[model samples]
Target: MKSSIVLGLGFGDEGKGVVTDWLCRQAQRPLVVRFSGGHQAGHTVVDGAGRSHVFSNFGAGTLAGAATFWSSYCTFHPVGVANEHRALVDLGLAPVLYVAGLAAVTTPYDLLYNRVLEANQRHGSCGLGFGATVARHAGPHKLHVMDLFDDFVLEQKLGSVAAYYRQLGVSFAEEVLEQQLEDFYRAVDYCRTAIHCTCGRAHFKNAADHYDSLIFEGSQGLLLDQEFGYFPHVTRAHVSSRNALEMIREYGLPEPQVFYVTRAYQTRHGNGPLTLEHLAPQLHPTPYETNVHNPWQGEQRRSLLDLNQLRYALSADAQYAAGLARQLVVTCLDQLDGPWWVSDDDRRTTLDTVSELAHRLGGHWQNCYGNYGQAGNLVAG
Candidate 1:
């Protein structure tokens, strides 16, 4: 009844994908479950087939014959899920993914509201209706996948949402509204027959009873946790092991080892804290691509720096860390170049060479391993 939950300790894109894929490969097969967030997540898993799949809706275990279950906390984009299914099928993999019938759907209105709100006012959002959708469902006007089964209820909810948006001076074209509703209904139909999920509790209980291990995968990173994160700028979801542990407890599964996935260098997609200017000269340069179009245009890549920020994040989520994590997994060690530094130095750092910048920062290094092909090697302390 061993159950493990792998999560990002920092902001989103903390290499949880590689960690999840590695665990799946090690198990050869396991029940993988996604507990939080929604289609806004970008999980990149490079499979044993050497084909990489970026998961937005589906879990990473799809390639390795792991059955995936999305809990009610997660929000779904039917089109995104469908596209992912097609991608998996094209790769000769079974897209046998299931979602809780109670999982909320991200509608076009949600996307529109997200774009409009975050356009000029920068909230460091992914512009994927992640926050908007979550906020909408947090109150009296909640709508879930099950609600789509009732036409009157669904229409009433949509009308309410539309009226609320109109008060905000955001109007949708009638045709657009009609088409979105149609698409929503179509997706509900497709999901009901193909990918709808039930027995969420039974699935976990069975996995705990029948399997050697159960791995819970979390999206986003801890720094973005709504409760513990930088206020107003954080993600709406709780990106910590706490949520994972809660899910395990709810399912009556045995507590297993928790692994916190992090990268050697700090990387952030949207606008946020980064000691970019100082470290930029030494690190290998890359372009930052925006996942969506908005006022937060242009991609900015920065070099990893020794910031107190990581320590602060760790402290904030200490409770979750103290309870779940047995070890920390640092990824992308090979990708990093030049000396890891506390302060940016022009002389010792080089773009292609890897070196230690300072001894003080070097102490921050911990026990972790790296993945390369079939073998995973320990980074010598």
Candidate 2:
């Protein structure tokens, strides 16, 4: 019953996909369980076969033939899953996905409402309706993964949410709303067959017994946590190990080793308080990188390494993580040119080694890595 959790220490895009893929390769076909966030996730992985994928709704380890389980906390998007499934098939891989009945489902109305709200508020959304879905469910208008199978209940929820948005002064043309509703119903029908929708915790408990290992895959990052992240720039979901640990306990699985990942340089996708990001010099883009300027989230933001803030995140996570052993994984060492430096007041000091940075952060990790060049080859601690 060996299980491990892969979490992003910084903002999203901390190479969680590659780390998950690497962990899968380390084991004999472990199950990858998504515990939080949803379709807005952009975890990129380049496989041994040179095929690349940016996982959204699917678990990152699917590239390595790992089965996926979407727990109750994950905000699922059916259309995103359908699209990502095709991409996986094209790359010569078949994915096995299991969805918990309690997982939240994002609807077409959620997407439209998110776009309209972000257009006015500029909260730096991924425009994937993650926030809107969370907000909608907080009210009486709710949609769950299980509701997708019951057409009558699903339609009622959709209609209720549409009316709720209308009450909020969102004016969707009758024709447009009808078309989107039609599309949503069609997607639900397709996904019912496309995905494995299981009921309750026993399925996962059985999986816990059956699999050699389980990789609790977290999306987004710790710094963007809804409760702890810089307000206004934070995600609407719990982006840390909070949900994963709860699932682990409920299933009576062995405590998982926590693997914290970050880039050699600090990178933030959307608007957020990135310490000294604007002051630092930007590195030339990685050749295999998939994240770029997009209309929804704007440009990719980068900054110098800030270990002090990184330490703060570790400490914050410690409150929830409790007894789990922490491991550090610093990725994209290939992109770091010359000696690495951490910001000191207005001055910069050369970071002699990764070990020195680890010391400054004030913790002895169970394992430390400087992952560079490729995915499979790991830099020894």
Candidate 3:
């Protein structure tokens, strides 16, 4: 079976969604697998017809008639799924999602607590209970997709999760908690009609044999990984190819065709140490920009590409990426109106084209694709 993995090399918003959509549209029958992160993912995809969708619960390939398989490492939010399902329906697309039974379930309490925590800590959260859900799963009070099917089990687990949050000093008013529970159950009812649960690894194995191609769409970026990224500013999930590689090996799939994606420049959302923050104004804007200034994630930051950090990320993933056919995808090329500005250690270089940028970074990648504007338009270099 042909397997492809799309990863963001820098701090996200690197056009991974459009890249995944491109891969799906090219494949005969593609199954998009979410191997990490959760409902907090904001992968924006704009179709060739100018139809735009910022996929959170659904895979980025959903717009291309591709089925999504949410892996066990990911989290599931029933309310978010219900809302995104309706949104996709409104856009004239039938989204088919199969969530793993062992996937962690996020609740409204987790949502509220996440916002409260981010308000004080300001750790660049999407404020969608992604980290909170993962944190809750580690504790005694846990909820999973399997429990969502049984109402009695779901309610009991949710109550325990609420008490666990309360012990962490997060409290909610009686009516507030009641309303949150009401909306949660209502969303759960809608989700039951929309989503389907699977037997985790077994189902994934079947999918690998059934579909002609499997596109593993990863969330965030390599720099935001819980282990590799800077502390306190990193995400709770494994944004690297580690989780995806593990799943591929367990399922006995062939070596994956890994596509490491990044923008022509650098961009980061929320609070973090951006390499060249002053060069933000020098970059041009794209037509399908999805990230906006929000109270939760704050402003979407920008800078020139840091080749040093890109090399660091490549080294970090090198151990797990052995024997994998890898390529580089540089997106947002249309945003670069002038010379390609890239920094390497103490020195900087001004390259004329994407190929020049690739050459300066060494011979790690033999093939590179540059994306111009939105709509998943890619040109191989």
Candidate 4:
């Protein structure tokens, strides 16, 4: 199978949306499988017709007419998926989104607990309950996507989860959770006809015989990985190629092509340790830009490209990336119009920054994409 796994090498925003859409189109509209992350993801995809969407709870390849399969490693938020579905239909697009039965479901209680806990702890949560949902799965009061289809099981799970939160001293307006529960059911009913519940990885991997390729589109970036990422600021998911590699091995699929994405410069949303945190890059604002300041993630900060951080991310992700054909996708090249060097303080160097970074990244990258598209055609590297 002509399969490829797309990963983000930075802290969240690395243009994975556009890359996934491009790959889907190139692969004749292959199924986009989300391996990790959850509703907190903001993958911005700008189509060929200039219509842009920041996809969450749906695969980034939705704009490219690819079905989205939320794998078991993902956290399914029915409300977010329903909201996204409504928005996409308004934009004249119909996205086929499915959730694995075993995938954890994030509920209103989880969101409230997450917000309250983060407010007290300030651990840099996305305020979307993704971390809380993942944490809750360790106990018996867990909820999954399949529970939504069963009223008895849904209520039982909801009651147990609420009790668990109360025991954890999570204080919130209880009526709000009821309202959100009502909304959640409405959203689930709204998406019932479209979103299928299946053994996602097995079904999709076996069905790969019909499609030309399978695109494992990951959410967030490796810098925010739960296990290997830096503490306190990391996301609550495996943001590396590990899950994709497991799926490949489980289903007997072909070797995966690793497409690691990063912006030309370093950017971090919320609080995180950045090496060159002070070196500001020229960021000409545009409508297509997705990252923004919100109460959840605070400010979307920018800085010069941190090659050291990039190297660390690559190294940390390498444990699961063995034997994967590595490629690179560099976005936000427009920010590099001015004189600024990533490797050093010498801004007088005539060497192009992209070329320098690529050379440092090594010559093994089979493909290198600059900005929204490939910088240039491959010339027998």
RMSD of each predicted structure: 4.2, 1.7, 1.5, 2.6
Candidate 1 vs candidate 4, TM-score winner: 4
What is the C-alpha lDDT profile of model 3 across 255-361, one tens digit per residue?
78889898988899988777877765365755678899999888788888888888877777776886677788888878777777777774667767667767777
Query: Weakest 10 consecutive residues, lDDT, candidate 2?
Result: 277-286
lDDT of 1 by residue, 111-211 (tens): 77887777867778878787888988776556676666677887887777666667668776779777976776677666655685675775665664456
TM-score of each: 0.84, 0.95, 0.96, 0.93
Clashes of each: 1, 0, 0, 0
Residue 114, model 1, lDDT = 88
Error of 1 at 67 (Å): 1.5
Pairs that collide in candidate 4 are none
What lDDT score belongs to each candidate, Candidate 1 first? Answer: 0.67, 0.82, 0.85, 0.80
* Pairs of residues clashing in candidate 3: none
Question: Which candidate leads the pack in TM-score?
Answer: 3
Tens-place lDDT per residue, model 2, 3-118, is 89999988888888888888888888599989888889888887877877888888888888898988878788888888788788888887888898878889888888888887
Order of the predicted models by lDDT, top scorer first: 3, 2, 4, 1
Model 1: pairs clashing at backbone N, Cα or C within 3 Å: 339-355
Candidate 4 structure quality by residue, lDDT tens digits, 161-229:
889888988777869877988898888787677688988555855575667778999888999998878
